[model samples]
Target: MLQINNINKAFGTTRVLQNISLELPKGETLAVLGRSGCGKTTLLKIIAGLLPADAGEILQNDQRQNELPPQRRNAVYLYQEALLFPHLNVWENIAFGLRLRKTPENELKNRVEALLVHLGLQAEARRMPQALSGGQKQRVAFGRAIIIEPQVLLLDEPFGALDPETRSQMQDFYQKTAEQLQLSAVFVTHDLKEALRMGTRWAYLDQGQLQTYPTREAFVRDPKTGIEQEIEFWKNV
Candidate 1:
């Protein structure tokens, strides 16, 4: 469980987040929809402990973690770019975190190899990141993040740079991977359809305020979310 209470953030005089609060249950994905620069990424960064919140309580599984650093938070932040190490092959990239912790070489190899097969990337184990396609690269990135078994996965517009077909494919992969691993995730996006498709729980963030819906139907029908218009527009098309 990830608990956020009265989270606040500001840059100089401008407030980025205003008393934001939300709870994320274990193994649940909360899809957040917001406009650019509306503090979506800021919220994720706060939870991941990459950025400090002016005021708030961050709890993980009933433990207080507000003062914990990013490394101690056991959270991973992933952005749109794969940002994979160009110098490392797929095998090394996935095992990178494990090796950082100095896991046994055989254990690291086994874990990395298992993740490779799980992500259907065993054929590309020896290939460099530049040799892979967009979807494949994102898969590698995902594998790298999950191999360390972080408690929370914070994804910031991860598929925004992909083509429509690739975006959909990656979305499917994300859903399957999270479910299979029982990973808790917070996915931030601007696209309505993508949010609806990817999240088990839906929330809309506008001007630093967060609102969640009881169901997808409610999410789409709620006037404040502006998702109803998108649904109607697609129906007409």
Candidate 2:
């Protein structure tokens, strides 16, 4: 389980996160929906150890992580960009993290090969980053992150750059992969449908505060979520 306890943050006089708190149980995704500049990314950054919270405790499976660095926190953060190494091919890119730990050569080969097949990248294993499409590059990124099986995955609009069709496909791929791996993640997106599809638990963020919902019904009913407005827009058309 991942728990955020009374998290707070500020930039000089401007408060970005105000007493943000929530829990993500194992094998679940907490989708946070918010418009641009609503502190969603700030919350994820704090949880991933990329930024310090003015005050809060980050707990992973009951262990406190206030002072741990990003690498040691066992949480992996992926940006909208795939951010793969330009020098590495698909195969090497997926194997990078395991290599960092100096995983045995044979085990690394076995793992990377399996993930290649799992990600349908076996045919493109030797291809360089530039040769892959946007969706394919993101797939490689996901494979790289998941290969190490981190305790938590932090995604910052991971599919935001993709075209509509590719975005839908990636969303399906993510949902399947998350279930297969029993992934525990915090996915933040501004797209309402994406939020509804990706999250097992839901929350809304605005102006530095967060509101978590107990059920999908509650989330849809909340006026601030804009679900009602979305429905009305479609119905009148």
Candidate 3:
């Protein structure tokens, strides 16, 4: 399980996250939904160790993750953009992390090839990011993240760049992959429908605070929670 306790973060005088706390169990997916400037991305970054929290601690199981850097956390983060290496081909970009960790050539080849197949990117394995469609690039990014088999996965509007049709397909692919890997995922999105489709449980974030719902039905029926309010707000957008 990934546990976040009283996490607080600030950028100079601007406080982005305050007393944020969350817990995600293995094989469970949690969606973080909020309006712009609500600190959703900041929270995901802090958890992934990309940014330091001013207060509180993050833990995996019982191990302290306070001092661990992004690379040491075994927490993979997928940004809004695919962020693939401009100079590397699809296979190389997906194998980048493994290469950094000195994984054997045969092992790397097998793993990357398997992920390519799993993500339906086998035909594009040799293609450059520049040659792929928005949806395909996102798939490659997701494939790279999962190649490491991280204990926790953090997604920050990973599908925001794709069109509606592609976004829906990617959401389904992500859910299935997460289940297959039994990954604990924290996905950040402004789309309520996407959240409802992707997460087993939903967390509503407002002004840096997070409140979780046990299920989507509970979230939708109440229409009182921040998530429901945001959902209604976006319906007309």
Candidate 4:
């Protein structure tokens, strides 16, 4: 389980996160929705140990994670872009992390091969990043992240680069893959419909505050909750 307790972060004079708290169980996906500049990505980065919280604590399995660096933490972050290495072949790119850790040759080959099969990219294993489609590149990125078997997966608008048709396909693939891997995921997006479809429960963020709702229906129905207002705000942008 992942536990975030009263996380607070500030940059110079600007405060980005305030008293953010959340508990995520294994095998669950939580979607975070907010307007732009609401600090959703900052919060996700803090959880992934990429950014430090000015206050509060992040705990995994009841143990403090303050001492762990980003690479040491069992959390994977997928950015808005796939961020693949242009010079590396698909197989080499996916195996980069394992190689950095000095995994044996046989084990590395087995692992990369399995990921290629799982992501339906076995045929493109030797292709360069520029040769693959958007969805295929994103799949390779996902495979690289998941191959490490992280305890938490953080996605920051991972499908934003794809066209609508590809976006929908990738979303479905992500949902199924998360379930199959039994990974706890925190996905950040501004799209309400996407959040509702992908998340088991939804979190609403406004002005650096976080509130979770049990269901999308309940969240949309409550006028005073500001969820509808936030969605409208996103649409205008």
Highest TM-score against the true fold, candidate = 2
Model 2 stretches astray by more than 4 angstroms? none
Models ranked on lDDT? 2, 1, 4, 3
* Candidate 3 lDDT for residue 57: 87
- Can you give the lDDT of residue 177 in candidate 4? 91
TM-score of 3: 0.92
lDDT tens string, model 3, 143-191? 8888888898899999998998998899888888888888889998988
Give TM-scores for every candidate, taking all chains together and pairing residue i with residue i: 0.97, 0.99, 0.92, 0.92
lDDT of 1 by residue, 1-237 (tens): 898999999999988898888888989999999989989999999999889999988899989988888888889999999999999999999998898889999888889989999999999999999999999999999999999999899999999999999999999999998888899999999998889888999999988888888888888888877887776888999
Q: Clash pairs of candidate 3?
A: none
Give candidate 1 regions above 4 Å deviation. none
Better of 2 and 4 by lDDT: 2
Error of 1 at 102 (Å): 1.5
Write the residue-wise lDDT of candidate 4 on 1-237 in tens digits.
888999999999998899999989998888988888999999999988889899999999898997799988889999989999999999999998899889999999999999899999999999999999999999999998988888889999899889999999999998899888888999999887788778886788888999887777886876645668877899999
The alpha-carbon RMSD values of the candidates against the true structure, listed in the order shown, are 1.1, 0.5, 2.4, 3.1
At residue 179, what lDDT does model 2 achieve? Answer: 98
Better of 2 and 3 by lDDT: 2
Q: What is the C-alpha lDDT of each candidate?
A: 0.91, 0.97, 0.87, 0.89
Clashing pairs in 4: none
**Model 2, residue 165: what's the lDDT?**
100
